[model samples]
Target: MNNKEIVAQAVYEVVEEQLTLAEVERLLENPKSVDHGDVAFPAFSLAKVFRKAPQQIAAELAEKINPDAFEKIEVVGPYLNFFMKKEVISSMVLKEIAKEDQSFGDSNIGNEGNVTIDMSSPNIAKPISMGHLRSTVIGNSISLILSKIGYNPIKINHLGDWGTQFGKLIVAYKKWGSEEKVKAEPINELLRLYVEFHERAEEEPELNDEARAWFKKLEDNDEEALSLWKWFRSESLKEFNKIYGMLEIDFDSFNGEAFYNDKMDEVVTLLEEKHLLQTNEGAEIVDLEKYGLNPALIKKSDGATLYITRDLAAALYRKREYNFVKSLYVVGNEQSGHFKQLKAVIKELGFDWSDEMVHVPFGLITKDGKKLSTRKGKIVLLEEVLNEAKDSALAQIEAKNPDLPNKEEIANQVGVGAVVFHDLKNDRLNNFDFSLEEVVRFEGETGPYVQYTHARAMTVLGKADFTVDPEAVYALNDADSWEIIKLLQSYPEVVIQAAEQYEPSVIAKHSIKLAQAFNKYYAHTKILVDDEQRDARLALVHAVTVILKEDLRLLGVHAPNRM
Candidate 1:
């Protein structure tokens, strides 16, 4: 068992003799400091039952608690805190760090259960805007955390490869799109045609009718419509692959809305079998008024399937295929109502596991307190953001270290990491004011700062010609050393909390804190010395190197040893 689990078990044993395990768990809270002990229990929670003062109850428990594995017990106000032996904790941290390295903070808490994550469902033939950034990065990080905790995470890119948008594109393509232009710049050319079609539709209302007719033909499986749609899908995927390559994100499945075209009939059949479908104004919908949701439109009056219909089919198909313990939809908070209705309809259709579905909602990204909009062409392109950050980081590298090798490669790592780290440092539920100037700044709690700290530790390790001896018993009594050790010891807890809350920001914040602590310690202490203290200090430095590198890897940031 891990230290926290072990400590919890000890606390459980003490409370089990007097109270229920559930009650004990309620009493146990995270301690403010390691010195206040590994875990703490508040007597105030039990004061009414015991009919005694909180301090008296805490003192009584401290006196009754037997010292077996715990080092000591202390009573502070109404709190009873237990401290583990320092040597035991230090040794545990060191041994685990050495044994796992990159996998140090991981645990089998997920127990091999399956979790299906749907994210990055950017529309085909459209450039991925900064609007999709939150869903992509946040979903990827949640998947990484789940996998680290032993969950079989399935990453799905529900690409927007279907809908009337394709019809509009097809109509515009036949009218004005050039094959050569599309071949050379698939996304840009298609997007241009799409914009022009909408702009022209303002003057020519018949264009909308024509587009709808083309979509109907596509739905009827017309040969020309099918062929052109296939070409658009293939070309759009090629462009998406380039962006995915740059971000280093991969999906286990790309079964998008198009994949559910034939399966929607089955979903409708199931809904009918369960008597949950109702016709409203000639359009099929599920009456969700009783569930406190607006009626979810399943089919339009013209018999065209909506996004909700495709999603219903997709959800059922995933369950049949993966039998996931949880299915997470990592979409924006605006879609919360959509998911609420979706889950309600699934449950009404008698799918018991529908309860496992979750909407991992996040707020929109804005600039100057205004929401980004693609229709108005008032949004930042994701590629532009990445490129700007890279260029800015490259300039910083040239100014800071003129002799740095592979400047371009290091720039890519630092720049991309900065964008990601900045997005993740805040609460996922809160909207962020995104600014290039703020995200790329290398000073204070940024990705570049953390990377520099890792690089510095590498430099220290290279300067010291010392080897780590696992058998050596290093004394860690110095204040600086203890501070570093305490941070290292808390790594697993940080991972657990991040996983439980489905928040990558927690891990991102913890990594920056560790890097900052290490930098402070390095500036104050000397690692390479001419005495036995050198070996112990070198070992500590090595430990820091191991952790910072691992933490950066978890954040998907590259730590160049020579940066």
Candidate 2:
């Protein structure tokens, strides 16, 4: 059992069945100041039972409570503070890590239920930009975090492969006349025509009308439009896959907006049967005034299906396919209202499963303090940024460890991991500016700092010739070791907390804290001396390596054994 459970059980014994063990555990809190103790319990709740002031009750309770698990119990005002035996906790935590290794903090809380994550979706004819990084890394990390806790997370890249955008691109391509250029560089050529189409549309409104006409033709499966759309989608996926390979991410589903084309009719039919469809300004919508949301537009006045219509169809499809316990959409904060409308419309259809859908909204990644926009052709390409970061990492590795083996592999790990880590380190809803230099640096709460710390610990283990010894008594009571042991023990709880809140930043922040603590310990501790505690100290270092690796793994980062 963890220290908190041990303390709770001890208090449960002395309460004479007045409070259950679970109740006592719930009541326990960490002291604001470490000087108070490790765990604190306020006696105010028990004052009525003892008919005494909280201070007296705490004093009496302290006297009656067993002290085996604690170094001491002190009564301060109305609180009973517990300082656990550092040696005992250190031993338990170390042995547990040695035994569990990569499986230390894993749990089966999900009972193997499925969770659908819609994330990393980029449009068909555009390059994946820095703006898409937030959803990609955040969703990827959440998938890893959920899997660590036993949830089967199905990642879906809901590619924006359909709609008027494709029509606009086709219009631009035909008018600007580009078949050979597109063959040479698909995304760039397509994006160029796309941006030019928007620029021209501002002055010539008729271009938009032509774009709409072409989209209608594509929807009706006109041979030329279909061929062009398919060509564009195929080329885009090839480029997108190259980037996904670099990031070490994969998706279980690539069901984009087009996949639900035929399925949308079912959604509209269902809404009509339910009598939830309303006419608003020649458009078809679902009135959601009761849910305090705007009317959800299902179909445009032109008889074209809207985004909400396709989304409703996709929701129904996912339910029938995955039977997911929870469905998450890792979209941007700007689209929060869209999801609210989606869920409200689903509820209007009388599907109770609508309650299980969650919109995991996140803020944008900006450049020069401005949001990146694809429409204006103003954005940073994610692939270019990753390549630059990788090159930067390689240069640093050459300076620090020139002879390091597998230089390319390690540099890729460090570089790609740095970008992914930077995106995840921030709170999901907090917008932040991106800088390549700051992200890949070897110090200052960056991914490389944590990676370097892990590498440093591994170096210590190698020098000591350390190996897992389940038979050895690995224990340490030194202030530094105790702090790490406490953090290690709380890892299981940390994973649960991250899963509960759908937040990856929890794991990211915990990793930074642990790395900082380990660095401090390494500076002052004589861990390699010929002494009785040598093995235990090395064991602590080994434990740190295991956890730091696992922690990085959960955040979708890698921990290299060497810098």
Candidate 3:
């Protein structure tokens, strides 16, 4: 068992004598000092029931508790703090580090069932903008966390390869786009035509009707329309694959909106059978007024399927196909209402498992507190961010380590890793003011710093020949050693917490903390030569290197042995 679980269990044993384990867990508090205790249980909440002062109650419990595993118990005011034996904590830290390696932080808490994560769903024909980074990174990180624990994670990319937007693109391409221009630069040429079409659309409104007619023909599977649509999708996917490769992101499913076209009719029939579909004007909608929502439009007056219709059909299809334990939609917080209505409509159709559907909403990525929009052309390209980061990292390497081999390669890893780390080091609910300046600064609490720390530990290990054995005598009585050991011991807990919260930010923060602790320890103590104490310290450094490498890997960052 892990330290957190062990501590929690001990606390449970004490509280079970009085109240239920659930009640006791709710009343438990994190201890302020490891020196004072491993875990602290506050008696303040029980004061009213006991009819005694909290401090007095705590004192009584302290005396009554057997000092078997714990060294001592202290009652300070309403808090009962239990200090564990130093040797016990040190031994557990060494044993766990040696045994688990990369698996140290994993747990089986997610034994409930599989989790389906829908993320990184970039649109077709549009170049991936900086705005898409949040959903991609956040979703992938969450999937990593879930998989680390015992959850079966199914990653899906609900690519925007269908809709009225395609009609406009098709119209634009037919008018001004050329096959030669498309082959040369698919995304760029497609985007140019898309923009031009919208621009000319203002002067010639009839073009809109024409585009709609083409879309209708495409829906009816007209030979010409189908041929063009398939070609567009194939070319767009090819371009998208290049970017996904660079980012190291893959999806189990690329089921685009168009995949649900045939399924939508069945959904519409199901909704009609359930008497959930209503006609508003010439358009088809689901009257959600009773559910405290505005009418949800399923189909337009032109009989074209909308986003909601596709989403509804997709949801039903996924339920039948995967029978997923949980279906998570990693979307922006702005879409919370839409997801709520979608789930409500599904539930109304009698899908009992609809309750398991979750909308994991994240706040928007802003610049100077303003929302980013590609339509307004006020957006940064993700490729630009990556290039700038690499350039910045290369400059830093040239200044500090000019003699380092493969400098450009290392720079790419560090630079890209830094940007990814920064995005993940905060709660997903918090809006991020993305600043390239801040992301490239590798000085403090950053990915580069952690990578550098790992490299530093490797350097120390190279200077000495030492192997860490959990059976080796480890003393945490010294302040410096205790500090490092404490951080190492908390590694598993950090991973568990990150998995539980569905936030990779927790793992990112823990990596920085571990790196910071190691750096401080290295600066204070010498770890490589002729002394017994140095040999022990070298062993500690080796253990830390293993941990640093594993933690960075979890965050999808490369941990270069020499940085």
The collision pairs in model 1 are: none
Every model's TM-score: 0.93, 0.98, 0.93
lDDT score, candidate 1, position 81: 86
> lDDT tens digits, residues 1-563, model 3?
54445555666675575677667666766677666666788888778878899899888777766677676778888888877666677666766776666777777877846788888888888888778887888888888788877888888999998877778988998889999999888888898898898899999999899898888888889998888888888888898887676667788999988898899899889988999888889998898888898888888897777788889999988888888888999998899999988988888889889899999888878888898887887878887788899899999989888999999889988988887888888788888898888887767878899999999899888877566776676545556766777778787778788876778888888788888888888788766657656656776787788888877777778888777
Candidate with best lDDT: 2
Question: lDDT (CA) for every model shown?
Answer: 0.84, 0.92, 0.81
Q: Can you rank all candidates by lDDT, best first?
A: 2, 1, 3
Candidate 2, residues 332-396: lDDT per residue as tens digits?
99999999999999998889999999999998888879988876667899999999999999999
Tell me how far the alpha carbon of residue 533 in candidate 3 is from the true structure, in angstroms, after superposition.
Answer: 4.2
Off by over 4 Å in 2: 202-204
Best by TM-score: 2
Clashes of 2: 0
